[model samples]
Target: MVKVATTPLDRTRVARAALKLLNETGLEGLSLRAIAKELDVKAPALYWHFKDKQALLDEMATEMLRRMNEELAADEQPDTEWPDALSAALRGLRRHLLMYRDGAKVYSGTRFTDMSYAAPMEAHLRMLTGGGFTPGAAARAWLTGYSYTIGYVIEEQSMGPDPVKEEGGYDLAARAERLAAYPLAAAAGDEMFRDYDAGFEKGLAAVVAGIGATMRDAPGA
Candidate 1:
């Protein structure tokens, strides 16, 4: 006979518990039963709110986006520079995602059609439009910036902590030395490794600059 688990679950409580578990166990270790246990509810109860694990995962992604939405509202509102404003908003989102384990993984491929995400998305579009970008160009710009932010953070998080294990660990240094044949890689070295926030800022700025340049060069926009 199979043993069954016991716990209470609802959408709100389960989602909250799921996020907590995600922070602790990461996406690979996440499970419906694990979340049910966190909420002190039966696995079946969790099923009532979420049809399956994928649904739960999707909801978790939404929760992360909602947190980003809140931060952008408070800190990344439309400013004098539309590109900078969009970049800042995306960087803010990356910061929030970094707060959790496998956060970018969870957010990746998740859809943001919910009304909650619409306001921010619309604001970004409006800001781009105000900057003289055509609708098609604005959409591309938004996607490009968003993808860059997400891709950067995903790679940043996957690299895990510094590869250096011991105080005198040569893992990083040796790796750097081995890249001598690759001029760009060797030149990057420690300079490429940066504080998460700084990386986000730098990347965001670069992407925004690229978009601005493109917009300026576009004909009849």
Candidate 2:
């Protein structure tokens, strides 16, 4: 019989198996052998598509981005207008990251030097520019908001609560009691620990409004 070519390994399948493993085992437990086992293949099979563990993780991150793209694609009105459309996109992106076990870590570290991520930024820039922001102002606005959102989500997800036991949960009231001298900080202590959605919205709105105000105040703007 003539030699035949077996089906080539698909990176997407490998990535999906890896992400599933991540959800079950956490990031520290991720490994090529684990993913291969998940796929019912040998570890070297993964190497055909990914050079090593890091490469596999990077592809998994890209898969996470693809998930964000799907959400953004589903939004019925992504290009409706300035802040409206851009906010929808950003919210979709953030929500997708929050869905995974360690979504923020995957997004921040992935060398997504790929067009999928870049195209979104370009679309956002167009939205900002259409909203009367100069090129420099638009760029700065996107960067500031992006940075703040990513940083906030990373911290939030990293410190996500464990439901198995409540013994180690954050003690906002106890801390407030200790910081009596710092009136303002103490007063807002409980507020800071409110639901993540509320906090994320508050911060995002503040940043967007501040950026708009600054752009309007600029000379000739």
Candidate 3:
């Protein structure tokens, strides 16, 4: 058995250290032991603060959301339309997720460790409700946008974080060769794999439009 450290550690400090290590190692290689070494402590030292890896992940995701919220708040405008506000929020989420390797994976399913998420979420719902959507419609609209943001980031990170800068990650020529039997599918690879920024914006625009068309009703209007 390994020895435990007697020194006390702050949970946020441990989580922040883990976030930095995440960029170097990616999610598959991150472990409590690795984090302990990063902090120059024994593995058991982490257990006192985090019961297990999942608990630590919860905190990490929470911290990521907190930072994202801070950024969004800085850019927020009181008079902005609901669609623009929602788009900005999701765009902010994507930017933050792309900051770390497997950042989307780290954030996707983990539960937040605190109530910090409440304010931002409530604000979003209120924005939708104020825009003339029913409560149920507002909730659904927010979820649809949030889900798209998370899913898009997951795929974006899969090609290596910063697919734009990663060299030789997607071999369009080889992919086309393999799909020679299906010329259309082969030709589609470039549009699908390259220029993620434009693709994301186009897709998000469609999602927001659909939400507005389908959900913006006064019930009695």
| lDDT of candidate model 3 versus the reference | 0.87
Model 3: how far is 115 from its true place, Å? 0.6
Query: How close is every model to the real structure, measured as TM-score?
Result: 0.81, 0.80, 0.92
After superposing candidate 2, which stretches have Cα over 4 Å from the reference?
1-8, 76-79, 162-188, 216-221
Instruction: Give per-residue lDDT, candidate 1, residue 188.
Output: 75
Per-candidate Cα RMSD to the true structure, in Å, reads: 5.4, 4.0, 4.0
If both were scored by TM-score, which would come out higher, candidate 1 or candidate 3?
A: 3
What tens-digit string does per-residue lDDT give for candidate 3 at 1-221? Answer: 99976645779889999999998888888999999998889999899999999999999999999998888888888778888988998899899998888888999899999998999999998888888888899999999998998898888778533533454457788999999999999999878777889989999999999999998886333
lDDT of 1 by residue, 109-194 (tens): 87643577788879888888877788888899999988997888787767646222312222556776899789788767565554
- Each model's lDDT: 0.74, 0.74, 0.87
Clashing pairs in 2: none
Model 1 / residue 103 / CA error / Å: 1.2
**Runs of candidate 3 exceeding 4 Å displacement:** 1-8, 160-165, 219-221
Task: Name the 10 consecutive residues with the lowest summed lDDT in model 2.
Answer: 160-169
TM accuracy, model 1? 0.81
